[model samples]
Target: MSALVDMNAKSGNLERALKLFEEMPKRVYRLSKFSGCSIATLLKVCKTTEHLHHLHARIIRKGLEQDQFLIAEFITLSNSLASLNYSSSVFDRVISPNIFLWNSLIRGYCQKRCFQDVLSVFIRLKRQACLPDNYTFPSLIKACSSLCNVEGGKSIHGSVVRHGFEACVFVGTSLIDMYGKCGHIDDARKVFDEMTERNVVSWTAMVVGYVTVGDVVEAKKLFDAMPQRNVASWNAMIQGFVKLGDLSSARGIFDSMPEKNVVSFTTMIDGYAKSGDMVSARFLFDQSLDKDLVAWSALISGYVQNGQPNAALNFFLEMESMNVKPDEFILVSLMSACSQLGSLELAQWIDSYVSKSSINIQQDHVIAALVDMNAKSGNMERALKWFEEMPKRDLVSYCSMIQGLSIHGQGAEAIRLFNRMLTEGLVPDEVAFTIILTACSHAGLVDEGWHYFRSMKHKFCISPSPDHYACMVDLLSRSGHVKAAHDLIKSMPVEPHAGAWGALLGACKLYSDSDLAEIVANRLFELEPRNAANYVLLSNIYAAAERWIDVSLVRNKMRERGVRKIPGCSQI
Candidate 1:
C-alpha cells in the first residue's frame, strides 16, 4: 500500500496518493519511510497551503522530523508558495541541515524577493561552519544586487574567493551582474576582464551594465569585441541605442542581425511607435508571421498612444480574431481607446469580457482604468456606478472621479471628493493636485484655488509646479481680475510659463486691452512663433480698441511669419 502511494505521488497524482494513505492502517506512516516520503512528495504537487500544513504536522508527529531529505522537500515546496515563515519553521525543526538544504532555504527567500532574509541565511550558514558552494554564491550575490548593497556584495565576493569558487563560470556571471546592478560598473568590468572564460550571457551582462550607466558608447565597443554573440546580446545593444533615442542606430543593428526574434521585432516596433512613426510600426507588425502577446500589445499601445483610437480598436479586434488572449496590458490599452471615443457600448463589452474571464477583479488599477475610460468617454453616470461598485478604490479612482466631476461642472462635488481622499489618509500626488486646481479654475473659484495652491506647499510639502501657476492665473483671469492675474504672473518665484502668459493674454482679450494685448502677443510670438492665434487675438484687440492701423500691422506681421489662423466653424 505504501509503495503504491509513493508511486502515485511521484507521478503527481496527489489525490490517488492521499486516498491510498487514508485507506492505510493506523501508525503506517510512523513505521514506514515510504509513507513519509510519499506525503512529502505530495506536498510538492499540492496547491493548498492548508493541506501542506496538515501534512507538515503529520510528518513531525510521525517522527520523520530527523529525515533531512524529506524536510528539504517541504522547505522547497513552502518556498514555491511564498510561505517563507513556514519554510523557516521546517528548517528550524531539522537537527542539522546539509549544504543542499541550506541552498534550498536561501533559494526560497530569493524567490520571495526577501533579500535581507537570504543574507541572514548566509550569515547563519557561516556560523554553522557550512561553507557556501557555487550554488549558494549565485543566489546570495543576486540578492545583494537586488538590494543594491555594494558593500555587502564585496564581502560576498571575498567569500567567493576564499571558498575557491571564484573561477566558477555561473558564479562569475552573477558577480558581474551584482556589481553592475550596484552601480559599480568599474568593478563589474574588472571582474569581466579577469574572467578565465566568457559566455554570451557574461558578455550580455557586462553590456547591459554599461547601458544602465548610460555609457552606450562603451557598451557598443564591448558588443563589437565579443567573440560570439547571441540574440540577447544583440537585443541588449539594440535596446541601448533605443534608450538613447538613436532609432537609426537601433534599426541599423536590427537589419544587420542574421535572425530576428520576437523581442527584436517588439523593440523596433516600440521605437517607431515612440518616435511617432506609426507607419513603420504597423509595417513591421504586419510582416511578422508569428505575433505574440507582447508584439500585439506593442502595436495596439502604439496606435493608442499616437492618438489613433480607431486604429487601436482595429488591431485589438484582429488580435481577438486570431484567438490571442489579451493580458491586463492589452486590456488597459483597449480601455484607453474606449475611454477616448466615449463609446458606452465598447466600454460595456470590455467590462463584460473582464467579468467573463478569471482575471483578478480585485486588481485596483484595472478597476480604476475602467472608471477613467467611462469618465473620458462622456459617461459620468456609468463611471460613478463603476466607482461605487469597486470593492477596493485606490487614490487614482478618487482622482479620476473628482476630475470627471469637475469636467461636468460639479466643482463642489470634486472638492468634497478631495476632502474625502484626505479624510481617508490618502496623500494627493502632483497629478492629483494639478487636477484639483484645474477644477477650481474651471468652477471660477478664485479664492478656493488660491487656498489650495498655498496648502499644496505649506501643508502637503508639494511645491506648486508651472501647471499650478497656470491654473491660478486662469482662475484669477476668468473671475474678472485680469490685472491682478498679470501681477501674480510677474510675482511668481519660478519663471512663468507660456501657459501663464497665455492665460493673462486671454484675459487681455476678455477686457479688450490694446496695450496689454500688444505686450502679451509679442511674448507669445517669441515663445510660440508658429501659433497664428496670438496674432489674430492681437489683431482683434486692436480692432476692438478701434486702432485700424495697428490691426493692419498685426495682420501683415502674421502673413510675414507665414502664420495662418486655425479654421473655425459657425453654428447655423
Candidate 2:
C-alpha cells in the first residue's frame, strides 16, 4: 500500500492514490503516518473550491491539519484559488506558520492586489523576528509596488541591504520594479545601473518601468543596448511603442524582431487597433499562427475600439467555435464590444456567464467595463445595479455610470451617483468631473454645473483638463451664457483649443450674436481652416441674422481658400 501510494504521488495520479488510501486495510497500515502527504496530493487533484473544502475536511478527519507540511501545502493550494476572500480565510487559519507559509500568503495577497494585507503580514513577520531570506523580499517588494508605497519599499530595500540579499536576482528585479512603479524612475535606473550582473528579468523590469512612466524613449534605448533579448523584452518595447502612439515604430520593431511570440503579436495587434488601423491589425491577426486567448482578445478589442462591435462579436463567436476558452480579459473585451454594439442580448448572456462561472469579475477595471457596456447598451438600470453591486468601486465606474445616465437623459440620477461616489471617499478625476458636468448640461442644471465646475479645483483638488474645460464651455454655451463662456475660455491658464472656440461659436449662433460669432469663426478658421463645417456654421449664423453681405463674404472666402466641405457619408 505504501509503495502504491508513493508511486501514485510520484506519477501525479491523485485519484489512484485516493483509491489506494481507501482500500488499504486499517490493521496493516498506519493511516496517521502518511496522511499529510496523501492529503496534499488529494488537494492538488481537486480543482474546484468545493472539492478543496471537501478534501480539507477529510484532512481534518485524519487529524493532519496540525502538520506543518500539510498546512504549507494547503496554503499553496489556497494561493492558486483565484477568489481572494475564499483563499484569505484558509490563510487566516494556518497556526504559527513558517517562512514558506508566510511567503505563500504574501504571494497570494500580491496576486489579489490586497496590498494592505500583504503589508500587515510583513509587519507580523517582523514582529515574529523571522529573519527574511531571499524568498521574502520579492513578494514584499511586489506588495509595496502595488500599493505605490515608496517609503515602505525603501525600508524593505534597507532590510535587503542589511540582510545581504541585495545582489539576489529576484530580489534585485523586484526592488527595481518597486522603485519604478512608485514614480521614482531615477531610483529605478540607479538600481538597474548598480546591479553588477543583470538577468533577462532585470532588463525587462527596467524596460517595463520606463514604459510604465511613459518614458518610451528610455525604454527603447535600453532595448537597443541590451546584450540579451527575450520574448518579454521584445514585448515590453513593442508595448512601450504602442503606448506612445508610435504604431509605425511598434510595427517596425515587430518586423525587425528575430522571433515573434504571442505577446509580441498581441502588442502589435493592440497598437493597430488603438490607432484605428483595424484593417492592418486584422490582416496581421489572420496571418498569425496559433491564435491564443490573447490573440483573440486583441482582435476583439481592436474591433471594439474601432467602433465595429459587431465584428468583435463575430470574432468572439468564431473563437468559441475554435475551442479557445475565454479568460477574464476576453470576456471583458467582448463585453465592451457588446456594449458598443448596443447588443443588450449579448450583454445579458455575458452577465449570466459571469454569475454562473467562478470568474472573478469583481476587479474594478473589469467592473468598469461591465458598467460601460451595460450603460452604452441602453440598459441603464442594469448598469446602475452592477455599479452598486461592485465590491470595490473606483472613479472610473462612477464616471461611466454618470456618463451613461447623461446619455440616457437621466441627469438627476447621474448626479445622485456622483454624489454617492464622493461620499464613498473616492477621489473623482477630471474625467469624472467632466461627465458630471456634461450630465448637468444635458439636464439643463445650470446652477449645479457651475457649482461642480468651481468645486473641481477648490474642493476635489482636480484641476480642469482640456476635456473638463470643454464640458464647462458646452454647459455655459448651451445655457445661453455665451459671453460668460467666452470669458471663461479667455481666462483659461492654457490657450483654449479649437473645440473651445467651436463651443462659443455654437452659442453665438444660438443667441444671434453676429459680432461674437464672427470673432469665434475667424479664430476657428485660423485653428482649423480645413474644417468646412466651421465655415458652413458661420455662414448659417449670418444667414439666420439676415446678414446677407456677411454670409456672401464668408462663402466667397471659403471658395477662395479652396476649402471644400467633405461630403457626408453614412454606412448602415
Candidate 3:
C-alpha cells in the first residue's frame, strides 16, 4: 500500500492514492511508518484548505509530525498555503524545518510578491546555518526581479557562481529573466550567449526580455533564428508585433504558422482590434474552431477598444448563453465597454453582479473602469460614489475622474479633482496633466493651460510631450490669437507635428487672418502635400480676399497635383 501511494504520488494520481489510503485497514505500525508520505500525497490531492488542515491533524494524532520527512511535507503544504496567500498557521506549527522547507517558504513568498518577506526569511535561514542550495538562488533572484532590486539580484548572481550552479539551466534561465526584468538587457544577452546549451525556455526568456523593453525588432530577429518554435515562442512574437502596432506583420506570421492554436488566433484578433481593424478581427473570430475564455475576452476587449461598446455587451450576452463563465478580465472589459457606450443600466447591472457573485474585482483597473463608465454615462455623482468606494485608489482612477469631468466641460471640477489627487500625495503623470490641459483648452482657459504645461516639467518633472504641445496650440489658437500661436510654434523646442500645424490652420480660417493663414497653408503643404484640404484652405483664403488670380493659381496647382478635396456635408 505504501509503495502504491509513493508511485501514485510520483505520477500525480493523488485521487486514487487517497481513496486507497482511506480503505486500508487500521494498523498502528503501518500508519506510523507510512503517514508522512500519505499526508504529503493527501495534501497534494486536497482541493481545499479545510481538507489540508484535517489531514494535518490526522498526521499529528498518528505522531507522524515528529518525523523529519513528515515535517518537510508539512512545510511543503504550508508553502502551498502561502501560494494562495492564506494563513501562516502551518508555518508556525513546523518544529525544525530543513533546507527544503526554507527554500519552499522563500519560493512561496516570491510567488506572492512578498519580496521583503522573502529577503527576511533568507536572513533567518542563514542565521540558522541552513546554507541555500541551487533551489535557493532561483527564488531569491525571482524576488529581486519582482522588486527591481538590481543590487540584490547581482549579489545572488555572485552566490550562484560560488555554489557552482551558475551553469545550471534553470538557474541560468532565472538569472536571464531577472537581469532582463531589472532593465539589464545587455547582461541578459551575455548570459544567453555564454550558456553552452539552450532550451525553449531559455530562448523564450530572451525573446520575451527584448519584447518587455520594447525592442520588437531584436525580438523578431532572435525569434526567427530559433531552431525550434513552441506555442509560447509564437505567442511571444505575436504579442511583440502587437505591441509595435504592426498588426499586418503579426497576421502574416500567424497565417504562415503550420498550426493555428487558440493563443495565436487570440493574439492576432487582439492585434487587429488594437489597430482598429475590427472587420478583420470579427472575420477571424467567426472562423476560429476552438474559442476559449481568453479568445472571448480578447474579442470583447477589442470591441471596447474600437468604441463599439454595444457590440461588446452583445458579445458578453452571447458568451453567457454559450455557458462560458466570465472571469475578472472579462468583467473589466465589459465594464469598460459599458462606460464607452454610456450604458448606465448595464454598468449598474454589472456592479450588482460583481457584488452578488463575490468575484474578486479588487484590482485598480476594474475600479477605474467602473469610475470611467459612470463618468461617461454623465453620472458624475455615481462615478464619485464608486471612486470613494475603491479599497485602494491608484493614478488611473484619479485620471479617469479628471477626464470624465473635462469631457463634460466641467473644467473647474476637473482642476479641483487634480488638486485632490495632489493632496492625496499621488504625483501626477503625463496623462493627468494632459487631462487638466484639455479641460483648460475646452473651457478657453489659456492661462491655465500655460501654467499646467509649465508645471508638467517644473513641478512634476515630466517633459512636455507632443500631445501637450498640441493642446497648448489649440488653447492659444481658439482664443483668436493666431499669430501668437504661430510664434509659440516657432519657439517650440521640438518640431511641430502635422496635428499642431493643422490646429493653427483651423484657427487661421476662424479668425480670417490671411497672412498667418498663408503661412500655415505653406507649412501644411510642406508637411503633407497629398492632403487636398491644404490646397482647399489656400484657395478659400484667396477667394475670401477676392484674389481671383491667386485662387485660379491654387486650383491649377491642385489639378496638377491630382488632389481632390472631400465634399463637406452634415448628416442631421
Model 2 ranges with Cα > 4 A deviation: 1-261, 267-280, 306-308, 338-358, 423-427, 461-473, 480-495, 511-516, 567-572
- In candidate 2, what residue range of length 10 has the lowest lDDT sum? 26-35
TM-score of 1: 0.82
Error of 3 at 200 (Å): 7.4
Best by TM-score: 1
Q: Write the per-residue lDDT of candidate 2 for residues 71-135, one digit (tens) a residue.
A: 76777787775466766566567677678777877778877778888888889988988777899
412 Cα displacement, candidate 3 (Å): 4.0
Candidate 1 minimal-lDDT segment of 10 residues: 29-38
Q: Any runs in candidate 1 off by more than 4 Å, and if so which?
A: 1-90, 342-356, 385-398, 422-433, 453-466, 489-530, 541-553, 556-562, 569-572
Can you list the residue pairs that collide in candidate 1?
A: 342-377
Better of 1 and 3 by lDDT: 1
Clashing pairs in 2: none
Worst 10 residues of 3 by lDDT: 81-90
Candidate with better lDDT, 2 vs 3: 2
lDDT (CA) for every model shown? 0.86, 0.83, 0.81
Most lDDT-accurate candidate? 1
